[model samples]
Target: MLRAENVTLSYGAEPVLEGASLSIEAGQFVSLVGPSGSGKSSLLRAIMGLQEISDGRIETPLQSTDIGILFQDDALLPWRTAIENVSLGLRLNGRDRGRAVAEAEAWLERLGLTGLGRRYPRELSGGQRKRVALAQVLALKPRLLLMDEPFASLDAIVRARVTQDVVNLVESEGIGVLLVTHDLEEAIALSDVVYLLSNGPHAHISQRYSVPIPRPRNLVKSRSHPTFAPLYERLWSDLSDVVDGPRRIRTAA
Candidate 1:
């Protein structure tokens, strides 16, 4: 359960978000999609307390407020092995070192990262690293997971697998997730509710598409579904309006 009410974010004189609102009930997976500079990342950081919202309110259950965040970058410690990296969050949360290591290892196994834990970040491939990163967050058992392009770095096949793993985690844990991504297909494939923001210094929700696909949705099958084509076409059209928006000009005398 997370909600941003009449949210606004500005950088000095420039505004990036205006009256953008989103609500996620427990166990819902929501995607925020928009063109570059649409303020998707800003909205997420604000909700996570990493950025200050210029105005409005963000509310979530206190206990669940310690949300987990996964970024496009794995953000793993280069020197640390996978298991060590995974346990970092738990360690910071006052978990005992031994117990944290054990828990992290268990999560790694669940995500299909068993023996890989001994490898350092540099030794792991991109997909392996992302899974290690995901394992790190999932190990926390966060109530809300904020992801900003979690699959951006992986290849298509890897991305699909990672997406499925993430979906599985969300369902099993029943945690709310707000993911910011530019990929319309990825958003639709993985989310229950998709929010599209128009591009601007202060972007607003241009449209919110609710996916009627049944629970336990499949990314591949959903792509070829009849409704998928129309919905995706519209989402792309909305996003392109901003991505290819007219350039501001300087008037000359």
Candidate 2:
């Protein structure tokens, strides 16, 4: 549903990404992974129209309202109850109060929040807050989801559970996702296609790997898949090269 073609992004004269391109179809989970400073998050901002692109184009048939975003921070209002937070977008978009609340309640239930909807963000655990943030986005029935390391803050076990919840929920909803994460395992476990970006000042998509592991994936069990380790190693090697290429060149010189 979304395509970015040979896109370029910059801050002042310094380019963060150049000639980077990726696409996501309906119900597809695509991931972008690379070392730190590879402009992964900047690419997301470019897609969201939050950052202006200096070259090429991003084409999406859906409007801005059809996109949902989840960041590392939950970004939920502390004072708002879980249900209130989830329903806020709908109400802002002119949905009736009752309908919004009902929809929010349903989404919370889907994400396993259920009776906890009355709790405020502070009262909820980190994982719970992330789920609420997720429900808030999903409640909008967005066609595209842009996630920037949304689960990074959670502990490993919680991250796995929450990641599973995300996978199940998005697949069921047929929402296309473009996730930006440093976690290669998470990418392999969740994505159908994983695109690797080169280390920046002019980062670009260096390689795209189509995951051979079948789904509906069990995040933990999938790691044991025969194809998983090989793919992970290849990705790891590629990322390592991108990260260390300059140093290697200097050493050779």
Candidate 3:
């Protein structure tokens, strides 16, 4: 549903991305994994039209208003209740207040947040807030999802649970996703395609790997698949070569 061809971006004289290309099909999940300075988030910003690309083209059937993004931080309004937060997008779209609330409640329930709708961000746990943020995005019915390490801030257990929930929900809705993450296991487990970037000052997609694993993946059990270890090792080797090298440690964007 979205394609970037030979996209380029830079800050002043230093280029962050150069000739980086990738695509996401309808209902397909793709991920970008790379060192901190490799422009993963910058690529996302470019795709979202938040940053201007210096070269090439980005083609998407969906408009900027149709894309939904979830950031590393949930970015929920502290004063809004969970349901209110979820309903914000619908409200902005001119949905009826009652209908928006009802739909938001249903989505909250779907995300395993049955009774937490009335709670404010301060009252909810970290995971619950993330779910609210997710509901907010899904409420808009985005054709493409742009996630910038949405699970990175959560604890391991919470991250795993939320990740699984995300997979189930997005698959059922047939929404395409382009995720930016440093976690190779998360990328491999959740995405159909993984694109690795070389280290910056000017990073490009150095390799692309297909995850042959089937959908509705068992978060725990899938790790034992014959292909899992080898894929992990291969990705780790490639990633480590960039991050652990003599280059300065730059966290994955």
* Backbone clashes, each candidate: 2, 0, 1
Show model 3 residue runs off by greater than 4 Å.
Answer: 244-253
Please tell me which predicted candidate would have the highest lDDT against the true structure: 2
- Candidate number achieving the greatest TM-score relative to the actual structure: 2
Show the lowest summed lDDT stretch of 10 residues, model 2.
212-221
lDDT by residue for model 2 over 14-77, one digit each (tens)?
8888898888999999999998888899889888889888999999999999999999899999
- Report the error of model 3 at residue 45, Å: 1.4
The superposed Cα distance between candidate 3 and the true structure at residue 104, in angstroms, equals 0.8
Error of 3 at 162 (Å): 0.8
Candidate 2 pairs with clashing backbones: none
Stronger candidate by lDDT (1 vs 3)? 3
The lDDT of each candidate is 0.87, 0.92, 0.90
- What is candidate 1's local distance difference test score? 0.87
Comparison by lDDT, 2 against 3, better one:
2
Q: lDDT at 202 for candidate 3?
A: 82
